[model samples]
Target chain A: MTRLTRAEAKARTRERLLDAAARVFAQKGLAGASVDEIAEAAGYSIGAVYSNFGGKEQLFVELLQERANDRVNRAAEIIAEAEPAEANGALGRLLVEVADKDADFAPLQAEFWLYAVRNPELMETYAERMREPRRLLTDLVARSVPDAERAGELSSIVIALFQGLVRMRRVDPDSVPDELFGRALRWLFTGAEADEEQP
Target chain B: MTRLTRAEAKARTRERLLDAAARVFAQKGLAGASVDEIAEAAGYSIGAVYSNFGGKEQLFVELLQERANDRVNRAAEIIAEAEPAEANGALGRLLVEVADKDADFAPLQAEFWLYAVRNPELMETYAERMREPRRLLTDLVARSVPDAERAGELSSIVIALFQGLVRMRRVDPDSVPDELFGRALRWLFTGAEADEEQP
Candidate 1:
């Protein structure tokens, strides 16, 4: 293994801890999951998790922040390339890219939602931790469709549809086709598939 | 109300128990939820819950069965209408109609999923619950696209997208417009919006 500088070592350890936390959370869920199990998964001691993040819930919030950030950062690139009325496919592609990039992401979304439902504490922290997706998509939709308000409506539904589809597919692969996420949105954004329908 | 016969009372009481259980499960979730709470919610004594369902887990399974049977009963009406090409849109409309008919339904769907995550034992049951939605969509996609197997990639994605949209909209009303659900599918199933795209 390559030797790391002090900063690199810190980053690596943080990443390892986060990785461990995801598996622990997935396996045990929020209420049943513990810091010790998370530490064990990361190949570190419990202290490492505490040292990096104050507690189990804090660690979970950190995990949520990282994931939410990753999505926004990735989406920004897709949006940057988009132009007025020219982003018909760009918006759809960005979402498809997300669905295709990580098979495990949808489960985390569902798991976090389950967390939010069970614990009222997480619900209030949502805008603080996870409002970017809605905000960004709203802006993207406004840009892509005319009549910004009406267009935004379509965009929001498409987004909701996209998210719902991901959760369903992750939970049961046999039931939902993998690429249906983008195809559905493509139909919404471009209105390209409408004519393909049989009369 | 007319006085019920013995069997009628038994059936009525069971229905009340299930309704109460649904509310408790939706509010507190399956793991954190209790049998006593369910019984109380149903306006019955704790002894009644045990007498009727045995325990919390068994109550949960029965809840799943009841929800499944309810949907199956709804699908029976749709099965008689053999316009498979139009069936996908029909399913989307059904979801909307559900929300319009009873605002409580989607929240309950979210709760059912929360239970699925808290107890892995519920995963199989949840998957079974999802089968009808998939079967409905797949059969429709097959009739419309004719290359459904080859288009498996896109099909999976649309399912996820549909679930995501439904859940997101159900969770937040302002962010998701009411019309997009039906309109998007109409566009997807027919070419209602074909003129909007640039040639």
Candidate 2:
């Protein structure tokens, strides 16, 4: 049998538990998933699940935090790699590709949001976690746009547009074409220029 | 009891069933809700539900169709009433207001979307229904923008932005402000102007 240090074993167990939680939650939904099922899926005992993470809710929150951070980091990398002029197009393409590829993530996210909204305390904490990512995206937008004045609001729109489009695409792929994103970005840029010229 | 034609009685029963469905689906979700509960809530027998709609799936689809039509019509009215110059701003304000005022609508819409994505057959038909509203909005955008070339694409963005912002508001109200919608519209117009001036 493979041997490991005490702390290393504990960390490995936690990782397994989280992986199982995400899969179970995605397949069965937050309410539908149970601690026992997650533990079984993780190949651990019920006691191990409790010892590793206090409960299912904590496990879920951790997963969301990890995902949020991972997404922002990945976005930063994409933005960093793209030429300044092509940054928006690259990001738009990236967002669409991510949304298309991850069938589990979006539904899981929507389910989590629904669950969090019903619990005021959870919602508050989750909302706080969201701020860091939103701030990062806002700063990124300000840098990308020709007019930095409206960057904050425009960034929010871009984020919202990506989310809403992905959601529609999920339900009906034919309606939301990949090229529409580029066109929309161009249109928004044109609008921003007009606004800047106004006396 | 007042005398009524057979068709009128059937219509009344169908309406009541739909009303009950909206309430139940919002509260309990598609999977969580049962046909018996919907019928009981409607104050009709199970047979009335089956006779009127054939099944829960049909009932849900009808509800979606009704909502989709209602939203497009309302949007058209909002656009029609606004002066040409103020159309985009007016639409932005209206979307925000509608999202803020109707708590039930957004959740119900999300739930319906979640339900549709899981069922491929339903998604195809639902997606088809979506195109009409998108076309209507696209035509509206073509008329609103100073530059009509990118209007169709811009319209999709506007729709996605509205949906995404409302969703964020539902989960975390502080992050998505009411005024942000106007600011976004303004930014897009400015960007468009800048594009036009570019050599």
Candidate 3:
């Protein structure tokens, strides 16, 4: 095994701690999870967690921000790859596909939001953390849908549907086929007249 | 206080236990919560919990079912109260209003869903519980929307948006206005032509 410098060791510890926190948070939830468990899961001591994250809440905030950025970046890439005309459809397909592949993501997100709501301080940070993603979503919706001004509303609707479907899919996968989200996006962009035309 | 009959006393204990379970589950989450803590919160013995619920998992299932029924029944009542002509708008308004009024319900629902996903044995029952609400929502959408066959898809979309908004609202209330949901419903029924005219 290659030996690591102090800086490299610190970075490695932080990354491992974050990865462990994600798994533990998803499995046990935010409010109910313990930091010692996170440290152990990372094969580190409690002191490592403290030196790296200060505490569990801070760790969670960093995790959430990292995740939010990943989602927005990945979505932007999907939209970028598609032609302007197909960007909206591509966006819808990407959202559904990501949710299908990342089963842990939804529960971890749900736990984060649940913890955020119960703790006002966390909610403020979370709300701020969410701004960029919403802005990106709004811009994409504006470019796709005919009514540009109401893009924010459309974005919210799409996001809300995405989150709701993710929750439903967790308990009832059969009821929430990925095609369902695609149909909703079509309806949003092209109207109900078009939604019925699809199989 | 008036003395209670045996049946009335038993009912009161069960009710208190369920209420306590909701609070405990919300505060500590399902997996982390213990039957002893729920019993203590309800001012009963662990024996009472076992007598009423068989175990923690059973209690959680009962709580989830109760909450789902409460949401559907309340929504049905709201739709029922509205005139047929105004039903769609009224339905959207009602969903938002109910969500705002019962903030705890969303987090609790999220927690329950996370738990359900982790526990495969519970998913079947949870899905079964969800079908009635979805059916009711589909029927309501069919009556209000232009296309009868597409109503189920529309219903799924609306429900997904509602759940997603609830999750988002918990973190960032400012970004996700309750009116957004109302407008989505209006757009679904009347299309973008109607959306542009709304304030």
User: What interface RMSD does every candidate have?
Assistant: 4.3, 2.5, 4.0
The lDDT, on a scale of 0 to 1, for candidate 3 is 0.74
- After superposing all C-alphas onto the true structure, candidate 3 shows an RMSD in angstroms of 5.0
Q: What is the two-chain DockQ of model 2? A: 0.50
Better of 1 and 2 by TM-score: 2
Show where candidate 1 strays beyond 4 Å.
A1-18, A43-55, A72-103, A115-131, A134-147, A171-175, A192-199, B1-15, B43-54, B68-104, B114-125, B133-162, B192-199
| Comparing 1 and 2 on lDDT, the stronger one | 2
> Which docking category, incorrect, acceptable, medium or high, applies to candidate 1?
acceptable
Residue lDDT tens for model 1, A88-168: 456556555555566456556666665654455665455344445656666666654545665566656655665665456
Q: Which sections of candidate 2 miss by over 4 Å? A: A32-62, A65-69, A144-149, A197-199, B5-7, B34-58, B65-69, B144-149, B193-199
DockQ, every prediction:
0.34, 0.50, 0.46
What TM-score, to 2 decimal places, does chain A of model 1 have? Answer: 0.71
Task: List, in the given order, the native-contact fraction of each candidate.
Answer: 0.45, 0.65, 0.62
The top-ranked prediction according to DockQ is 2
- In order, candidate lDDTs are 0.62, 0.73, 0.74
Candidate No. with top TM-score: 3
CA deviation > 4 Å runs, candidate 3: A1-3, A31-37, A45-47, A144-148, A191-199, B1-3, B31-37, B40-47, B144-149, B191-199
Evaluated at residue B58, the lDDT of candidate 1 is 82
Q: Can you write out model 2's per-residue Cα lDDT over A1-199, one digit (the tens) per residue?
A: 7789999989999899988888888766665678899999999878998897778778887887666446655676677667878876887687678668877776777776766655667877666666666677667767756565467666667777877888877876656677777656776766665666673
